[model samples]
Target: MVEFAMLVIVGGALVAMVMIYLRGRSGFRVANPESGTLYVTGVSPRPDATGAQYVTITGNLTGPSVPGTVVYGRMAWDVNDWPAIGDLIPVVYPSGKPERWQLSRPGARPGLGS
Candidate 1:
């Protein structure tokens, strides 16, 4: 009985792990990264579930699409790393899909007053 119980517990754990992995992968499925512009809109006053801040951005994407298609996106950042309002930041997103984007320069911080 004890062995059977342990086996069931292990199997349940494995199934849970697989489900979590699949969900994460599908939730963040972006591809064909291309350069786009980010117009800082505002920063959230409260932190997210992970205790990270979120910056809101809205702008027209420069990818292959019907021009003038604006995208509104929010990116998580450290509390002290939020961008200033009206700032223009270069970002990369999947071609024709600027909603899912990230900073073009790896590890680059925004709004340094430069």
Candidate 2:
């Protein structure tokens, strides 16, 4: 009975690890210049952080114009220069009021200059 229990525990752990790996590897990139929509991978912030989180976006390029290319962009969570990770916030452009962009849990790919 002890051996069987140990085997089951080990197997469960292995399965859990595999699931996590797959989740991390399942992300892809999608971009559309016409609509100005860019889907990035690895943009999710780490758990536990304050304001203005920084995340690195990476993956293959998609959309009408850009295809099979790699790009990067910087997304600022808050107005502060240093934002913490895992902070679900909107990115405020320099345009004007009510002009803001919110990054999804797993943010989009980093665009140019990121």
Candidate 3:
């Protein structure tokens, strides 16, 4: 009877392990990836261990369709790459969502900055 109980416990543990492994194997999810233009309203940099600046940028969009949707996001980069206030920066937003955006230069890669 004890051997039967031990066998059942071992079998249940093996099944649980397989289920957990399969769950974690699910792949990466993609973002909405909509691109647009927005103005930089402000920037504040916080120093990191690598000496790179982690900047929090607030975008002020003043367009006809997207009227005044201010969004704040952070990016890690060299100080030279930081955008100035009132500068019209290339912004990528989530599909059907303007408030979720990332600021970037023209011809640069999208969805890298957060």
Candidate with top lDDT is 1
lDDT tens readout by residue for model 3, 20-99: 88876652222856556776778784454454577788876544356568887776656555556766777666565676
Off-target runs (Cα >4 Å) in candidate 3 are: 1-32, 45-51, 62-65, 104-114
Residue 2 CA displacement from its true place in model 2, Å = 97
lDDT of each: 0.65, 0.42, 0.64
* Displacement of the residue 86 alpha carbon in candidate 2, Å: 16
Backbone clash tally (model 2): 12
Native-referenced Cα lDDT, model 3: 0.64
Task: State the lDDT at 30 in candidate 2.
Answer: 30
RMSD of each: 5.9, 13.2, 7.5
Superposition error at 30 for model 2 (Å): 18
Models 1 onward score TM values of 0.54, 0.31, 0.51
Ranking by TM-score: 1, 3, 2
| Model 1: residues with Cα > 4 Å off, grouped in runs | 1-29, 45-51, 64-66, 105-107, 111-114
Q: Looking at model 2, which ten-residue stretch has the lowest summed lDDT?
A: 90-99
Between which residue pairs do clashes occur in model 3?
Answer: none
The residue-by-residue lDDT of candidate 1 on 17-99, one tens digit each, is 99999987645544767776666555455444444566665665554452545667676666655566666677777776666
